[model samples]
Target: MKPLNPGEPRQVGRYRIIAEIGEGGMGRVVLGLAPDGRLVALKQLHAQFAHDPRFRERFRREVATSRLVSGAYTAAVMDADAEAETPWLASVFVTGPSLKEAVDAAGPLPVESVRLLASALAAALTEIHRAGLIHRDLKPSNIILTSDGPRVIDFGIARVAEDAQDLTGTGAIIGSPAFMSPEQAGTGQVTGASDVFALGAILVMAATGRGPFTGPTAPQTLYNVVHGTADLSDVPEEIRRLAEPCLAKDPARRPTPEQILNHLGPVPPGVAPWPPAVHARIRQQDAEVRSVLALPLPVWRPPPKKMAPRTKKILFGSLAAVVLLLVSGIVALGLSIAEYAKPEDPGVASLAVTEAVSPERLRLTDPCKVLAGRFVKESGTLKPESGSLHPARCKYTGLNGVTFNLQLGESVTVSGLERTDRTAEGLPLLRSTISGGCDSVVQLPAERRFGIVVSRSGKEGDPCKSADDMLTAALARLRTHEVDRAGDPASILPLDPCAVADPAVVGKNIANAESAPRTLRICEWQGGGNTLTVELNLGAYVADGSPVDLGNGVTGDLRGAGTTKCTVHWQHRPLPNREAEHVTVMMLGREGSGSSCDPAKEIAASIVPKLPKP
Candidate 1:
């Protein structure tokens, strides 16, 4: 939370503002102290959106539904003024990071932990469903990981059951594609079963690290949700047995939340529901909020200058590089975090894993030959093309904008395996999609990037099935060996950019990034209408835009315009060093939406510290 700025009002109605919690396109949220000394999370809508009649109407309906939803697993709304000049609502303050944050940082949960999460969330859905409301968006971020248990939040898209079919069935696609139910992914009618389906997907993410239905883009993911089977290979058998039925493509085939409760039994009380690491994070959050409470109030404090992006300490750990391929909807960009946790320690605080080379490694000559039939020659299908030679890859074109990709890279150390979501065809795969794309890696003793990525060029649901299929097909053709050296990429190109990326770092900027392999060096993410693209130029790039002093003697360039034309650029491991490497992250968007450089700079600041020291 940030201190209130100059001119920022300290009072809102009967509550006094304490600190700024968060701000986004929709509105800003603050911590407020009620007259009785209780804390509340107060959300104030933007003036423009608040003034729109349609927005107000929707807000009014949502507030009413939100009030009706009450349970131990859900946030309780205390008050709201929908008709006010600027609409606002106050809910019991929750001090914790989101489930998305928890997983993105720490990776997936163990079986027991996932079971606990599923039980609590199932109970939450039961209460919400009984209230005649269907939460259209039920993904990881919507659930807050509190000290007690998980609490479901964000009901802006929650709809009354009766009208759901009428609106959602008309092909007006919405909701987070990764967690969407089959019907919710397309023109099919939505029902309570839809939420059930999403719950199943959520359980899979909690269990392994990813949702069941996945793809490269929203459309591709949704298509997979509608046409493909949920990949349960990675999920533990016990959880998978329960989740499998819930992910049925036909909504009617899924079980009700009440039925889920029967199977799950009840969550025990008074005990911590998460692992030691997750609980530690929860405690950290609580401590931060308590610290905020200790500050004095009602002073005309001087405006604090925006702090420059701080520099981090140099490290000398035996680190594995990452190659990240991020995808998005509103925006698309990819980031590779060469900085990571030490290989043996896969925790968020250290470098994770990416395979460079190992003695027990196998080399791949052609990655495209694996998917001989997955791509077809049709109206929109383009012939297959070979990709980079360093890490070897193949790209195939398909009809109606469908495309498939295959890439090969060396393994990250064994510590990297601790964070995998599930295993497919005996291969360990990183399950979760920070953005929305579907991707998987083959099981290799020493490598972290035996990967196959299936990304389309638009918004899609989680496309795990397609990725699974690609992996399965590739495995049929995969050949390995016992080499003399550790596994590493043959060359810079064709390497999985995501293998070297730090999700903890990227999650800080792009909350829901979906990525794909645009090329050997370029990875892209589709975000909430913004795109983030990253490339490793390897001495090919020469900065042209004016330099941005991000402080500490570091600089980056800003250039371009709009969603598709603008670019954000910066170099990693600058010149003068024999070991210097050239890497850049660029965001492309349409014109008139403000400077893309702003976010680009923000991303650069976050990524810089993770790079290897010169």
Candidate 2:
């Protein structure tokens, strides 16, 4: 939640608005306090929709039906005013983060947690359908995870079953593409079964952090919903068994809410249904709401002012002089505060850094831009290499046999590092010198650090000095030109390499295999004296090997490296500039292991079919 901005309404009807909760394509939501002191989440429609008389009538009817929905797992709609200038509806406020936020912050849910989530959602659907309403949108963001259990919120898009056709007459899609049912993707009929399909997709996301049929673009995703297969390879076996039937191409084959509840059996009892990190977030939000409620509401009054033109002009001149003096004083005080806030201890200093930068903001940052060619030139006459194996890394090599490597979003340990007085954009810088290289780390939020390493074959010059110079240049560029990943949904830069590959295929290729993520874009499986590494990166595709057909109309370049290693690389799609989004599957085995390319080809074939097409 955030503080209300100027010009925002302080009160709507009988409820006093506290703060803005969030906003979506449809309208804005705010935390409101009822006259009786009950906390509620109130949603107000956009003014454009309120101007339409026919929409107002439909909204009035839908709100009435929504009020009838009363289930343990659903947020009960308390009241609404469809006749108001901007129609608004109030519902019970549930203190928790949305499923999307929880998953993005804390990663995917465990199997037990996922099972509990499924059961609660199924129960909520039963109540909604029973009231003759169908929730057209049931994505992760629409579900809230509380301490007790999950609550399905946001029925704003819901309508009576008989009225769905009328609502869709304009042929506008009504739901999120990743979660839409095959029927909804096309112009087919939508029913409660459509919700069931969305539930299955939600379950897949809860289990794997990615939807079963997600494509890069909305149109591509919709096409996948109608024709492509659901990718459940990353989903756990326990949940996949239940989600499979719900994703059936035929709506008649899908299970009803009651059937789903029966299949899942009873939900086990638990005080905390979410992971500890997620529970911490819930507690933080709860505290914030309490603090906000404790503060007294501000009283508004009109100013009383009457002055002659000459007197007003004289007062304005005096006011401007006083304001200039006050501004000068404030600037001096701010400088003193900044100096006082900089702690000597690195741990305490990191707290201030955390408040300035957030993990969500860092997730979209491009590491390559942080260590650009111009920044590298500041240290020496070094030139950038093609690209690193991961998207969050870059490499530069100089003709003088010097190499510099930079990586972003790393979990670094700074206990033994030497703290320096130098800082990059107010972020503390730590240094360490090793055998032939010097490393510098810039502490960021949540222990995430950025590293700059300078290496040389001989100690001809101070590598530490070079590392420091590059760090200064990188930080300066980050302040002015922090490059971000492409906004294109089809870009593979945001995907997890480990989750993209089929786990079963990896197991088949390497016996008793165990998977571990080396970086955000790299995953490795090792067992039985063999190792397989999968990487998702951005670079120019190397067409140096024979092109072999992979399944799903994709082809990959198969090449061998020496006697023990083989690699299969494929371009998923062309990116901006001369680079392309690509994947690499490399197999490494004992020296005597025969023809690793065969298994590498097989693994690449399995992964190619699951990726989103360009």
Give the number of the best model, judged by TM-score: 2
As a TM-score, model 2 comes out at: 0.51
The C-alpha local distance difference test score for the whole of candidate 2 amounts to 0.77
Each model's TM-score? 0.49, 0.51
- Candidate 1 — which residues are off by over 4 angstroms? 164-171, 298-614
Q: RMSD in angstroms, all models?
A: 25.7, 12.6
**Cα miss at 133, model 2 (Å)?**
1.1
Taking the tens digit of each residue's C-alpha lDDT, what string does model 2 give over 447-499? 35433333333355777767776766555555432355444445566565666
What's the C-alpha lDDT at position 473 in model 1? 45
Per-model lDDT: 0.63, 0.77
lDDT of 1 by residue, 347-384 (tens): 11111122212111223234444454442222122335
